[model samples]
Target chain A: MPASKIDLSPHNARAYLEPGPIVLISSRHGDETNIMTLGWHVVLEFSPSLVGCMISGGNHSFRLVRQSRECVINLPTVDMIDTVVRIGNSSGRSVDKFADNALTAEPALRVEAPLIGECYANFECRLFDDAMVDRYNFFIFEIVKAHRARRPKHPQTIHYTGDGDFMVAGKIVSRRGLFRPGMLGNGRS
Target chain B: MPASKIDLSPHNARAYLEPGPIVLISSRHGDETNIMTLGWHVVLEFSPSLVGCMISGGNHSFRLVRQSRECVINLPTVDMIDTVVRIGNSSGRSVDKFADNALTAEPALRVEAPLIGECYANFECRLFDDAMVDRYNFFIFEIVKAHRARRPKHPQTIHYTGDGDFMVAGKIVSRRGLFRPGMLGNGRS
Candidate 1:
């Protein structure tokens, strides 16, 4: 783990995930470890810090995640755009994603899945529900632990717009005054 | 209804929604109509154009959408950030969101819900599956029709990060050359 990274409350995962950046899902089963780029995900809840990820059935990581019932959601910044694309372009079945991409795999606090040290944030997740997995390939996971960089309050995240295009995170704008006091969950208002 | 808007294929809905922008969902039940701001949503599939939205049961629009089983997901650009926040802060039960926000309620082609004329795009959706709704407040909708502005290929969409703050959509980056031919669903590659 990087010294610059700090532990974060799992409940505050929404602050980093709600923006919908493309994330890398790292998983492990027995001796095998894999990483896959994923964008089809949503922040489902805050208290338990639940997130829903739609992993395609065809992805090699699917079997690993389904078998282990756990994975690490890694948030990569815009600086890792090329690496992100490359990770998404290749398959983890034949090549070891960590060694192939030259990404550092760091130990996570709560999950067996390793976290990508290059990512700005890493959320350790446990499968909370598998009810929708058979039908939609949607796995609802509860984020049990979170780690993020201490500096750069807002990192430039990359959002996939499909068809090989990406949208970078831009300027931050606040409407704290316009929000109802009860609606501001983070207490920043 | 605007001259600048054009009909789009339902499969192409990912081009507008995959980026994870905060969207305005318009719903109608009987004679009542309501609009609510939603950020918890994910693109579930492409061929059927499925989208999973976790609409909190407490929201006023929840009942309207649940009863009607239809909605118009309106994409509001960065220019409409204030309106988006205001819509999210207020309740549809007390205010006529369309009239109070000064947004035009244009009739949708496939759903009874009216589309926000000021939005960059509108996707008419019908509830595809309700199995997860009771357990997760998640509604799986299949986009039946889509409409978007012809110009300004990339709209500056706003993404919520809790605590009343928003991140606006920034520059457009493409890695067409790096993508596998089969992965480029839009045929641009």
Candidate 2:
């Protein structure tokens, strides 16, 4: 199938703005594998770590996460908006979405989940046994490994709005605080 | 007090690009009250209904969420990005951030937590239980009331990419498969 077209104009920007994280949640149930878009996810902890996401009971990916207790949280940039939307809209119940969308999938080093090649970052997570999954459709996972893509001079990403709209990463319009060495915070500046 | 400045650009966009929902968390401890930024949050379930957020144990806001078992989740759109960033960087620990930042705070109808003006949406939540929070620093909340700012022509929202970079809301790039009405598959397109 031809890749879905994406428009990043400011006028149609909301499609990308709603709870904006686009994660490729990959899992395997038995021998079958699938990937889905998840915006209802977050980092839960930093030490000995934990991460969590909300998955509706209706999704096939939810079942896979439940059964496997593992998944790869693949963070995609705006460049992968079309692919993210494609996988999100189609249910893996019947469609072989990976093959359908032509998304390149690679094995995760620490988890059974697969990672999408086009994404900017990948987090390999193992399910943290928690009680909220049923009470709130949320699952907490522990990050085992993380990878950042080759730095881009202007690496923009996509955010999800309520509807089909999406938002492309934008510029840093302003700045505050210090950037000099010997200052309190130090890293990339 | 003047708000502290943060050069969000240093994180090279990773600051705003974190794969999580940006939620405004509010709490009151004794005579002191505070609000802070939370992007490490998610909705966990629907049956008993619950919400989840990852908070640093050391922050004042975390103590509020912990002591009260009650908190609020305020969702803001792209328009509120400036306020969000301002509140995210400034702490209510020392100063009245609301007054300093020109932020308006009002009592939530359902919960004691305060609702922030200028945000597009809000979710009033109470802690679901203590089982997971103690182990993972994850707080799952039960939503009591949910509201949105007057509907926008296109309700695109701001998404953080990490550090100080954010993604701009975009348009409905395209769609596929069966026609739906809301948000890609839910129907609206």
Candidate 3:
């Protein structure tokens, strides 16, 4: 194809997953709490607990996250896509998403940011760079306290791709059939 | 759903995305050719153009890009995902991914890096932040040149959500249906 023809509209668009985990970001300035959808979060390092997320300046939660310097990354279920996309397309400046979606907010442990009760995983985070926020809309965070849902479900994580698209995680697929210790031939055994 | 019952295994499992956008990080090393898989990338800025991606600490491709502070971000299509994941999983240390993928490496006009012909969108990038990568495994690059696919298909972009699973971006829900202008009697509209 010529170098001038690729289109990025949402027609026949599919979500591309990077093979990582997903987390939602919840932030609050005062009594008002908001949740922004995300699948761009990644674990950059292990020691000292560092997490990275790229929030665009075009996003409303980006502003709140910048102001508070704190937010919660929550992992919602696939069933939450309708809500996720709705939040992504609409702005929190006008609509109260929690009130519109009937979602509840709970207090976080180490941060003032609120956590969405409907989410399965939550990460309370503190901001990393102040300059990058306005310049690149990308924020690196240090994870403070992590929380998991009270109940376990089978493959219940949700992955959000760009646009208004998402995917529900499938069953575990390992190198070996059912993952036997001797099955892996990498010489680790 | 008990917090104690939650297993962090899935969140920690390392997986590769087979079908996703192929980003070519083209760099030059001592008059030698260098190009590698760069799927951990995203648009970070709108005006003045910026992008971000992650490069392993020991990649030869990144070493050259760091030296010149210049590179190119090329976006491939679904047809090229197989090659994308292959290079991403394997290292450039053992094999030349461009030759393995049968891609043409041509020097960019604005940057010293080469551009991959297999990709649909190509962006010439200039280093934006070295601290983000040195500290957080995050590297930000600004786009100086961009090209579209030779053939434009439907508007579909791939996103890496996690695991080998991918979610195809579905239709664009109507913004008018969700919230019409002046529909909410409040002046906030």
Q: Provide per-model DockQ scores.
A: 0.74, 0.24, 0.12
TM-score of chain A of 1: 0.97
Model 2 per-residue lDDT tens digits across residues B1-189: 012211111111121223334667877656666788776655444344455666877677888878878876665666667777777776677778678767777777667777776665566677777777676777766776655543453444555544355554555443343224543422111
TM-score preference between candidates 1 and 3, better one:
1
Candidate 1: which docking quality band? medium
Q: Which stretches of candidate 2 lie over 4 Å from their true place?
A: A1-19, A151-155, A174-189, B1-21, B46-49, B76-86, B154-158, B168-189
By TM-score, is 1 or 2 better? Answer: 1
What is each predicted model's overall lDDT from 0 to 1?
A: 0.91, 0.60, 0.55
Provide the lDDT at B158 for model 3.
45
lDDT of 1 by residue, B2-91 (tens): 566898888888887878999999999998999999999999988798999999999999999999999999999988988998999889
Task: Identify the candidate with maximal DockQ.
Answer: 1
Classify candidate 2 by CAPRI docking class.
acceptable
B120: Cα error in model 1, Å: 0.2
Order the candidate numbers by lDDT, best to worst: 1, 2, 3
RMSD of each: 1.6, 9.0, 13.2
lDDT of 1 by residue, A124-143 (tens): 99999999999999999999
Candidate 1: RMSD over Cα atoms? 1.6
Positional deviation of residue B24's Cα in model 2 after best superposition, in angstroms: 2.7
Candidate 3 local lDDT, B1-189, one digit each (tens) = 111111111111111121133356777766766677654554444445555677767777877788888887766655665565566565666777778778887656677777776665556778877877666567767666555443432224343333343333333332234433432221100
If you superpose only chain B onto the true chain B, what TM-score does each candidate give? 0.96, 0.77, 0.71
